[model samples]
Target chain A: MNVGLLDADVYGPSIPHLFGIKQKPDIADNNKINPILKAGVNLMSMGFLIDEGRPVIWRGPMLSKALFQMTYGVNWCFNDRELDILIIDTPPGTGDIHLTLATKYLIDGVIFVTTPQLLAVKDTIKSIEMFSELGIPIIGIVENMSYFLESTGLKKDVFGKNKTKLAELECLARIPLMESIAQAEYIDNSIFSLKDCFSELAFAVKTFIEN
Target chain B: MNVGLLDADVYGPSIPHLFGIKQKPDIADNNKINPILKAGVNLMSMGFLIDEGRPVIWRGPMLSKALFQMTYGVNWCFNDRELDILIIDTPPGTGDIHLTLATKYLIDGVIFVTTPQLLAVKDTIKSIEMFSELGIPIIGIVENMSYFLESTGLKKDVFGKNKTKLAELECLARIPLMESIAQAEYIDNSIFSLKDCFSELAFAVKTFIEN
Candidate 1:
C-alpha cells in the first residue's frame, strides 16, 4: 500500500524521532514539499523543520497556517504514484488544529486512543463528541496500556479495568503495556512483539473505511 | 498555604475530576467569577462551565479569550483570605495557552513532568526551552511513572530508562506507576500512597520560589 503519514502535532512532532528521520524534506518543481520516505511510508512533520528541543511557540493562527501548509503544500506522490491513504496524527486537543482539519478536510474517520483511567476516558469522549458533532465518523477506540504481564504469569491491571461504556463505540484493541513497543525507536530493527494486535486493529480500520 | 488551581488545560480539564468538584462557580456582584472551594483550596476550570462530555470546540482566539476571563475574571479570595499561590495546570503542547501564560503573567517558575520515555522527555524539553526563553525560571522536573513494581519484588522500567541528559535541571522526584494514583478519583478518601514523593516535590517548589 502507498501510505503517507502527516504528523500534525505541530507543538511536539514525534514522527521525526519515531521514524528516526532527521533529514529535511526537499521542494519539488511544483513548489510542494516532498515527504521523506522510510520503511515504506512517506512522512512529514514540524520536527523536521526545527532543531531538536526547540518549541514551535506558535499561536492559533500560526498553528492553523502550519497545518494548511503541511496538508496542501506537501507532495504525497512518489514516481507519479499517488498515495492510497494519508494518515494524519493530530495533537490531543479540541483547538484550532482540530477545528481546521474538521472544517477544511474531508477526513474518512478518526480513531480515538485512550487509557482505561477516567480522566483519559473523559477527554477521549470529549474529542469523540466533537468529531461526531462535526459529522465525522469515529472509526473506534484503541484501549492502550490496558494491562501488564507479570513474570509470574499474572495479568496486572496497570492503569485499571476498562469501566467506562463508550456510548456503544467498538474497541478495536486493548493493547497491553509493553516495554518493547515503548523502546521501538531506541532498539534498531526490533520487531514489535504485539504485531498481531496491531494487525487486527489495522484490518478493522481498513474494513471500516472501505464500508 | 491557601492555594488556587487554575485548570488552563481548556481542552481536557481533569482538575474537576481529580479534585471531585462539580459545582459551577458563582458570579460575584462585581462580575468576577467566584472559584469553587474544595478541601480548603480554591479551584477554577472550564469543566465547571460546560456540560460533562461536551467538547470546548473553540478556535485559538476563543481559547485565549476564555483564558483571559479565567485568569482575570475569577475571584480567588475566600472569606477575605487571598490565595497564597495559584498553580495553573496547563495542557500539553507549546501553543497559545502556554504562550499567553508566559507573555501575560508573572510566572515564578515551571515544573515539568514526564515519564522516563524518550518521546515524553523530548516534548518536556521543548516545553522547558519555551518557558526558559520566555524568562520563566526552571523549577526542575518530575519524572512520573518512572517504574512499576511487580508482584515478584522486581522493579520494571515499563516505559524505559531515563537516558536523555536533561541539561543541569534537578529531578524533583521519580514517582512510580501506582494504580492508587490513577484511581484516586474513583476510590474516595484513598490517601495517595506516594505522598512522600509529592511532599518532597512541593517542598522543592516552595524552596525554589523562596530563593
Candidate 2:
C-alpha cells in the first residue's frame, strides 16, 4: 500500500520502539530526512532522532518546528516511489501540536481512538470538537480495549461498557484487549500479525475517502 | 491530613470530572483565586475555568501562565487552615509543564503510575530521568492495572507481566483492574471508595517523605 507512518507524538514517540528500529534516519541527497522502512511500511518518529530514554524538553515553538520538519522536510518518496498515504500518530491532547497540524497541514481525516472509559471518551469528545470546529472531517471512532476474552469463551468488559454516547459518529471497530497487540512492541513483532482484525476499519476509511 | 490537589494537566483536565466539580473558583479578597473545597480537599483545575467540552486550545506560554496562576495565584488556605501537602496531577509527558513544575516549584517527590506494559514503562523511564536530572526525588513506582481478578478467584495479567525492571525504586503497590475505580467518575462517585486500595501506596509515599 506504500504507507508511511509519522510519529507526531513528540513527547512519547512509540513508533521507533514499536517497529524495533533504533538507527537514526539518513539525510537524502535532496536534503530531506529519509524515513525508516520496516515490513513494507515507511516510518518516522522523534524516537529515531534522539537517544533512548532522553526527553524532548521542547516548548510550543520548538514543537512546531519539529512538526514542520517531520511533515514537510521528510522524504516520503522511497526509491522514487511516492507514498500512497501518511498516517500521523499524534499525542493525546488538543494542544499546540494539534493546533499546528490542523492549521498548517492538509489532513484527509482524523480517526479518534479511545478505550471504553468515560474519562477517555470525554477527552476524545474535546478533540473531536476542536477538529470539527476547525472544519476537519471526522472519520470515525475505534474503541480499543473494548473487552477481554476468557478461556471459558466469555467476553469480559474489563474497563466497563461504552455508555458515553459519541455524537452521531460511526463506531468503526471494537478492538479487543489482545495480549498479542500489547506485547507486539516489547517482543519485537510487527502488528501486521493481526491485519485481519482491522480489515473492516481499513475498508470503512477507504469508502469514506473515495466518496 | 490537610491535602490540596492542583490539576496541572492543562491539556485534558480530568480532575473536574473525576471529582464531579463544575463551579468556578472565586476570587479571594487578597486577589488570589480561591481553590474549590470538596470533601475536605482544596481542588483547582483548568476544567473549572472553561465550559464543559470546550478544549483549552492554548500554546506553551499560555499554559505556563495558567499553571503559574494555579500554583501561586491560588489561595491554598481554607477556613484559616494551611495545606499540609499539595499534590499536583501532571500530564503524561516530560514536556514544558513538567519542566516548569520541576524548575519553578519546590517539589518533594514524584510518584510514577504505569500499567503493566513495556511501552508505558519506557515512557515512565524518560520522565524519571528528566526529574532525576532536575534534582527531584522520585518516591517510587505504582503499577496500576497490574492484574484483573476473575469470578473464579484467578488473577489474570491482562496487559502482561512487569518484565521491565525499574532502576532501584520500590514497587509501592500493584493495583488490580477494578471496575469500581474505572466507573467512579461516570457515576459521580468519590474515589475514596477505593481508598483502601491505595492505602499501602499512601503509606509508602508518607514513609519516603519522612525518611
> Candidate 2, clashing residue pairs?
none
Q: TM-score for each prediction?
A: 0.96, 0.95
Q: Which structure among the candidates has the greatest TM-score?
A: 1
User: What tier of docking accuracy does candidate 1 attain?
Assistant: high
Q: What is the TM-score of chain B in candidate 1?
A: 0.94
Question: Best candidate per lDDT, number?
Answer: 1
RMSD to truth, every model: 1.6, 1.9
**Per-candidate count of clashing residue pairs (backbone under 3 Å):** 0, 0
How far out, in Å, is residue B88 in model 2?
Answer: 0.1
Q: Lowest-lDDT window of 10 residues in candidate 2 chain B?
A: B185-194
Tell how far residue A132 is off in model 2, in angstroms.
0.7
lDDT of prediction 1: 0.83
